[model samples]
Target: MKRPIILLMGTMIFGILLSVLISVLFYGKNEVSNSIDAGTKKIVQKEDKDPYEKVDKTSPTISVYNSSTNKIEEMDIETFLYGVLSAEMSSDFSEEALKAQAVAARTYIIYKKENNMTKGHKGADICTDSNHCQAYFSYNELKKNKGEDWIKESYPKIKKAVDDTKGHILTYDEKAILPLYFSTSSGKTENCEEVFSSQYPYLKSVSSPYEEQSPRYYTETKISKYKFVNALNKSYSNISLSVDNLINQINVLERTNAGSVKTIQIGDKKLSGRNIRTLFGLNSSNFDIGFENDTVVFKVKGYGHGVGMSQWGAEGMAQKNYKYYDILCHYYTGIEIKDIY
Candidate 1:
């Protein structure tokens, strides 16, 4: 009876040891799995944080490629606008016109930056080339053009224009529009489809009768027949034409909705109006060609592509007591002015 009781006690001890071993193995595996899960969650949380979370979205600093210096300069948005405004428009323009320019320029840079349309410029959001991006004027340049006293007087006005329209941008369908402004118009703005391949509703043709007030409204460029033929040959090497053939064949075939030339037949070689303008260094495509005493005379009626906002037209409206918002609305059809901030 004692032996049987001892054997029973040993069996009970063995069963207790086996239960403890199983519990230890299962608990150890579960703890490791829970730790791994906790670590993975921590990694995910860290990865989700945005680097620019603390940045000010309203007024971000931009990198400008100074083409003259071949250097990248960092500048605040408003400060950059001061340089652009000084270079783009004359200080003699009215306060309202300056204000309109400020808003348009601000919108333009914002659009360019957002779209990464800097044309592969390294480490720069924009360039100082007016043909590529927008023109910029340094303080010294402004002083040289307008004198120190005038800069002191006009700088504040330009700053006021930028300040008054701070964070303001033109939007179409709640997105920022590509606000393009030119020196002057040919009494009307061209549709986007006429100049560019894309058609934009807000960039439609609009009458701008006030641009005649601009000093650059009308310009005349003259090229001799020999020079004209030489330029054409340089552009189109295969073209074999005499001055007489050019004179007889070179005629405006079609005009855009805004009265700018669409196409011109130059000795059986059809060239775009823009191409002719570039080849001859003409001011704008809105031109009339004529032969005057062995010279090819081009009478240009505008100072730019005849699209988007006309800067001189804005000045004219401002001179007539129109507000900045009114000028913007007139130029950019069916658009809303909103504060980005």
Candidate 2:
């Protein structure tokens, strides 16, 4: 009995000692890891010397401006390109989305001096809806698969798009491209004209709301077999002239939520709502409210904001074995990618 008690006590003591040793080992490792991380942070915090001034006629740095904040900020060419590509690739997207954005950083330094965005603010949203300088692409995507081929293929396309729009301002003839936030309340795509409504909580409400005789228009988009096919063929805008009466057909190329057929009384003629609204702005007292409803509609065609870069379309073309330049040229017109610097 004495011998058995001694053995049991010895086993208990050994177990306790093992637990203590394990705890000490874990704590020592955690402390070492913390020290290394702290040291790394210190190195990052140290100010990087600006060697840009002493160098030769160097690359152009992108300037960011905030119209609302009235502040100007600057970023490196690569960082600026990354920001542009990231935002365009996915609105508030991650940096890992594209492989193309990564490779563009290297070539942009040599080919172009600076990039610019007209309506885009200086901070996070620095690129625009269109392919001007800030286009939608990802270098990170290309880096994952196909390796260096992304540079050989994706570089010239983006560089061309950027080069073409470089030094060019967005304008229709002499009319400046006034930046207007797509009141998503009206739905996506330029097809919908945005009218201010108290319904939108995010936007500033219009003071002294005007009443209009025109039909209260609401944008509604739906994807069925027909809409998808129409969008793919770019024939969504085509108006039908002939209808086979066998099907009891409405021959019009109809819009989604335009209410009744639009009518305009101009002098002696009654024009359509679409044409009249284009000529004269919406006037109150012209039409009375019939019914009311609210909803968010996706009227988007193609994809990716229908702006500068179309990632879906690019992927589509890539699947068809289209070169990256062919994809870029299809979306952006009159752009040449050249090595300037």
The candidate scoring highest on TM-score is: 1
- Strongest candidate by lDDT: 1
The segments of candidate 2 whose C-alpha lies over 4 angstroms from its true place after superposition are 1-58, 67-70, 91-309
- Report lDDT per candidate: 0.81, 0.33
Off by over 4 Å in 1: 1-58
Q: What is the lDDT of residue 298 in candidate 2?
A: 30
Worst lDDT window (10 residues) for model 1?
Answer: 38-47
> In terms of TM-score, how similar is model 2 to the real structure?
0.30
- List, residue by residue over 1-341, the lDDT tens digit for candidate 2: 99999999999999999999998876643412211121112101111221112222344565544333456656555445544544444322211213322323333333222232243443432433233434433455445643576567655554444333332222222322222221111211221232321221121211111111112222234333343323323432343322122122221233323122234332223435444233223221122212112221232212111222234433433444444443333333333332233
